[model samples]
Target chain A: METLFSEMQGALVVMPSGRLDTNTAPEAEKMLVDRIKGGMNQVVIDFTKTDYISSAGLRVILKAAKLLKGSSGKIALCNANAQIFEVLELSGFLTLLTHSDNLETALGIVGNPA
Target chain B: MTFRTILNAAFPPFSEARRTKPREMLFSVAEKPGIGTTFTVSLQHTLIVLTMVVYTVIIGKEIGLTDAALRGFVALEIVVMGLTTLLQSLPTRFGSGHLIVHTPSVISMAAFIAVANSFGIGAAAGGILLSGVVVIFFSGLLPRFRSLFPVEVIGILLVLLGLTLVEGGVQRFTGLHEGSFDTPTLLTASVTLGVIIAFSVWSPGRLRVFAVLAGVIAGMIVAYLSGLFGASQMAVVSSEPAFAFPLGNYQIPAPTLIIAAALPQLLIEVISAVDSIGTAVTIDKIDDARWTRPDMQMVGRTITAHGAGLVLNGLTGTPPLGTSSANLGLVAVTGVASRIVGTATGIMLVVLAFLPQVSAFITTIPRPVIGALIVYTAGYLMVVGMELILSRLLNSRRQFMVGLGITVGVSLMVMPELATGVPGHLKPILGSALIMGVVTAAVLNQIFRIGISQTARIELSGYSAAHDAAEFLEDRGAAWGARRDVISRAGITVGEVLEVLHNEHMVEGTVNLQATFDEYRLMLLLDYRGKAFKFAGDQTLDLAAFLEGDEDEDDLALDAAMSQMSGALIQNLADKVSSSSQKERAGLRMEFSH
Candidate 1:
């Protein structure tokens, strides 16, 4: 799996490709934590290219959400396929973090205040 | 726009939903087989159809037509069957564009004879004409009543249709002559049936497609050797003219309206139309592997073609025609369901009508061979019907719906005397096991549907709350006929929510679980006198800080993190979730799209 990182409207956009299961979740978590530590307070994870997610991936997102919240920052997710969205929903990630159907809305959500 | 254009717009040729071809089928509805394959498969279909024409001959003989006139009548019936079969295979406003063959209907034949015996032949034609109109009208209304025919009901119709053929199939297979079995006839039928089965099961590739034909050949040879096809039958075939015009010795009957004859004929035609629904479904299922539900639009078109054929039969002063299930069995055995074959078969039948000698030769095919074919078809229909019924998740209500339906249908077949006291007009509906069983099943389905609410509730208190909740959703899901996967997902989500509520100590006393299901979605509500969950908003637990805990606060931080994880899990499982509170009363609602 490859993870793409870019900047859109001052929010760090992180896109994970293929799967976001246990094998790739550690690398994805480290990248997000590094960006947060580097003062990128606003973040958006776009799942347009991602096809799957497991419980480990969910834990990584939860940890990122917690870290961002401690700094009074916001994180948003977008473009999740049905399977990925189902995982997010079932894991209760949707309740804790903002999500949108597309990247524009996700960026808009994260760029703005709570 | 022209009338045909208007009709096409009203009823499209194909269903809106596309279907995948079944893997078992060698040729599907839209597929075109090679010329040789098409002709060979068409020949098999044509032979099956020729066997069915015995009904036409019987109707003609019963009506006391002279030999010359009877020949013309049979020819006319064959021509109508060919035209209708051709129409049914074409993608026209009237055709279903499926490999549906038409033949003289046994159900309509008895009614036709009864009308002819009571009134004149012209009156019988008039009655047949009326039935044609009624059937066409019913076809338009059939798609609207698709809900009336669930999978199980169609299954019942198919099973009963098979059951109804049992006596005929068995009698011919056993070669029962009067009270005693004919040894030669039994031997011939066994050879034919055995060959067909062997070729179908053991043979590979193209050989399977000609199983029925090979069986016929083998049976005929056995029959000839056993003296079943002696010089008498040979003489009968030789006496027929090599070629002759169908109308040479017969005049079209002048149709005259007779209410007594037309009403009964109309009623019987309506029932026959219902029978065609089963045939259409069988053919539809045979061609498509991803078959979820009946394509009612195509079924309507099938009935339209059927009714139109009856109209032709009326004009031609011949017996009423129906979609042939025996030919459907032939399609199943051959694994070929190409409309091209249907078209070719139609043309062959029409051509054979002008070749009296060929039709006579086909008519001389040993009875045991035809019987073996019917028995093969009967077995296929019964098995396919059972598969259809078992496809759905059956609850007690649906179980009764299928069980009672089959019981009622089988009862009529076993003890036909049950309909002895019924009025003559109602006999068409009540006397026949297929009609009664389907009617009973359809009616009982509606009756059983009553009082079965879309919403159900259960109380969850002790240790089995999660298990009880899953079981509750499962039972209600089956009753609602919801998709099994959706039901399974719903059960899992509900169980997770109940576990969270109990483990988190969010609920104090008994929790009332209410589930509401519609075709589109399922909503689950958990109501209890307990603490409402704090949904994730801006709140976040610093897991790193908690793990590196200042000793005494570690347990509290761990508890908070665990609670947050559980909340996330529950929220993610459902498509939408919300919490409601009034004083000590709290409720959590979760919705899942079906």
Candidate 2:
């Protein structure tokens, strides 16, 4: 349930380590959403260390995505494990979201929104 | 007002509630015993546990097994018991890591004897081996079907087993005649029992733990003097080779005999699983420091090991093995609750298996002495069973289940004549009081238990985090027939709540969740011993408001946003949510409606 918050290329990089299920999604949501509320729009959610993500986690990201959309801001996911990727794909979250294979690509995607 | 009244008024509603800290024990689960101590303690354990070898002789003799076959059986039993004890006592992947000795189970012995008597040795071996496989297969499925054999049911079975053992002891002590007591047998038994009691009462530290062994020895001496141990027996002992391949020329029992013995063997093996689990729990309690409710994983492994041991026993043409409850008491009394001791004991047993002479000497111990040991051990088991039953709050339902089991079990055991009129095949199943009682208890428990079987309490340790909790909800919700969408939402909501708690560093406590389902809604009731949790309020983002914010204003807004964000997802997902806290504990109730 540890989240590392960093800023690179004007986008907040939110790396939540461990599970992103009900037990941890709240902290993750608050950390990411607060950054968005603080006027940082572009974001990269690094899931390299996260092994599992449930719908509760998806909801948090979806909620943040909705808020970011209102402000013309964007969010991208990078380094997701198969389980998280499957969860995202099953929910059609990938359709609404942008994803990258690694942090550098995520930074590129969020830095230059297309 | 008087001074006392004035003082009481000033300190109104004072209570004497005390918080209990965790208990520490003299020896912990991880502690290793000294090498010197391990050998001495193991020797003491080996001596007492050798009684099982004597039991094999009694059962083997009745089955008319050849001396070589008997020797092979005892030797193989010793090795298997030792190996299984190592598996069970060592804190390994399979062992319970407690000071429990594995020995040939009397229940299995009885089943084999009955089967061999009716069908032949081959049938008995087949039944025992098949049952072992069944038990091994069943161990994996136990968690799912655990409700069928709850504490109450197992407790009743244990009590019945104890009573039955005592009954068998009395029968042996009274000789062949069921109605009359034999003077010589009674005297020998009395002397054995007296010596055991005396040693238990007055034997010094360490020696007291070997009281049973000492008593058996004393009984043997008395029996020899009384002409029970004659020249013929001495000749047999002298003729036994000092060394031999334990099972070199061992005869395999016919597989057809196994088919005939299958039903009874299955029944015995089923109970053996129950018995092993109970023994593991009892030993865990005996080794109190590292104790938690019998770790289901350990219990499962131990039961599987029991079956595997029985399979080996069948192959060796010996009896099935079980965790010895008497050895647990010995461990407690000796204050040597170490896996090292158990491992050493297992090794010694394996060595003993090769020594035909040693096995022969053990057989020389008179029948009355073995009977005395059974009576003493059975007495302990009966009390343990009674204590287990009484430990819980028994309602009318439990009373009925226990009463039915005891009444039926005791009657069948006490009245063997009832089986005389019954068919031969049914005798093994119906004739035995213990088996009958087990079935009665299990059936009654299941019938009564159906009323309140829907809810389950899952206690989460400090290590369990959000995903664990969410998975629990998802699994239970699915099982409870909740729709996928509802299950999904509930899982997310709980996961988010736990995450918030974890982030606040409020995760240093146990979390318990109770889930209940009905037609309208799925409810999750969460209780934990930690700081109270509050759902985050809604903080909808406004671009215009953010654009106009001061530099410091953004920081303040973020804090407000953080507070609001906690319950945002849960609020949108669940129909209703409520939380309350009292003292240091907190409870949350959430209901997800379709």
Candidate 3:
């Protein structure tokens, strides 16, 4: 699987394919912070197609969550499927990241927010 | 001793700072307690950014889109969305403190929207590829300048950006976007807004992370399960193509909106570079870490990111902006200072680029959802602006001039009709946010005597008078005397050493010096550059010295790279010094040859 992350303004947006487990968590976390240092504060984890995220992913999320709390920005989970949501819930990340069924719902929070 | 050893011996000792692992030090924040801690991404920002994206698309579709493209959009929406969210969630900077903050700097979105709007499903991959180039450039440019950017001006800008989107988001909410407001539309908009706000502001602990998110999800689910409106809403169950060819793409579309808007869009590029660099410097200072200059890497990366974005906009049907403050928020919260994380992000961007399936799904975030996130982002911008204002140490006068001017100028220029009489031909030229910044800076500077661009000169030699030259001077060997120099009042003879006894910039310091009265006078110049200047005796004897003592012990290999244009600048200054009695002092005339 491949994971790509980038930032615009001060937000980190990540795109991860395949399973997010212990093995890839470090890689993912590293990529997340690097893109963020230039200007990423808010992050959107698009999990629409993510098959599963293990406790490893949880660890990564927890780490990221804790990091964001210090700054005044936070993370939001978007595009999670049922399996992904279940996994997030089990791992406790669901509580930390704002979740949307799709990108549209996530988009609703801005200006003339729905 | 070998010649090499002699040359190496000439270099200074290691300044402890270089030995410190910037990367590791950056990452260590998360390891601490109460300082570096991460929280779940705020649903507020998630909704905000996502909503803006959807809103842009909804409005854009009204202007230009086909039914076939809409269907393709839905299918694309399903595939890479998880990747998009994951990508969106990674903190750019590692650390803690930013739990609820978010910034709206989506530069890559421009290329995505452009590609989707113009090329349909064909060019999305190409757009992502192009946009990646832009981001890398931004990373490079963010470290050259220091803490010049604070939230004051930025706060106003954010407010304006959010307010500007009001029309678009409201239109989407009313279904005026599609020319019909059904029950589903109102239900979706209202319930979604209320729920999201509740989650963003009132949610607690881990539950709070998903607060705005929970609201949006619940609102959508309610609409779907309740059969609130469109029958197609239930069609999500339909089994569509699970994946699409993200790479090995086909057909580039015509140079449509994507290509047409590159110039105006570049404004985001330049501003974000400045903003990014400013934020980086602030982070450094806040952490009490080693000083790092915002340099070519940051500036270049930022511009290139925007330029590359042309392709992303051309394909993905997303407006683009240079990611800025959000990363800081991420760092504030996460406290993970791993550049490796950024590497992961870069790799993720690459994955997103090739996987059209991925870009497709990320594009599906709803307009209203993104809209709410936009509010969060704007709020963050305001906070950042405040940070900038404070950092700049803006006093009452400086605050009134810079802050008020930027706010008013930005709002006026941003407003469409305020300058309605402006010719269409000049619209692009005059109607610019960056231009607004420059004007505000200039006008306010004049009133407050904060001249960001007033050249200082001696009646003898013309040069940039040292305003913020402390760093440059310190870097050089001139650690003696505090300030650089003062404006010369007397019209003196040639060969007199121009020592700055009292630099009236920020601090006051003396530059001791003397005189040699040849027709070609001996002038001592001290400007911030590669090398430093030193002076000893009264305004009788002073000399320019290479800042050889500031180098690291191992920096012997890199001393050549330390000074940028100082040699040429010194030479130029020396060359500019001419025989005043002979009527050829270029310093006085600046090559005013007749």
Best by lDDT: 1
RMSD of each: 13.3, 22.0, 24.7
Candidate 3: segments with Cα more than 4 A from true spot: A1-114, B1-52, B55-205, B221-230, B236-240, B247-250, B254-321, B324-370, B413-415, B422-439, B442-594
Residues B1-594, model 2: lDDT tens digits: 798785443222222112121242224344566676677668767766776677777787898878767777677778888888876666654456667788767766666787778787777777778888888777666655656766666678678877877866766555547567777788888888888778776776556555666777788887888877778887877898888876745576645534546886887688778878777666655555422233555566667677778777777677777778667656655556666788789888888778777767766667787778777768867877786666444557777888999999999976889888866656657787877887898898777756554576787665465556667765665344335456666666676667666656665577788888753567888888777666545433343344345544543454444434445545655688888888888888988764
Ranked by TM-score, the better of candidates 1 and 2 is: 1
**What's the lDDT of the predicted structure labeled candidate 2?**
0.70
Q: State, as a TM-score between 0 and 1, how close model 3 is to the true structure.
A: 0.42
lDDT at position B594, candidate 2:
45
**Lowest lDDT 10-residue stretch of candidate 2 chain B:** B13-22
Error of 2 at B550 (Å): 55
DockQ of candidate 1 against the true complex: 0.08
Alpha-carbon shift of residue B221 in model 3 (angstroms): 4.7
Ranking by DockQ: 1, 2, 3
Provide the lDDT at B314 for model 3.
Answer: 37
Strongest candidate by TM-score: 1
C-alpha RMSD over true interface residues, model 3: 29.3
lDDT of 1 at B371: 88
Cα lDDT of model 3 by residue, A1-114, tens digit: 578675544456677786564346679877775655544567777775565454445445554554555445556778876545644553334444568876555434211212
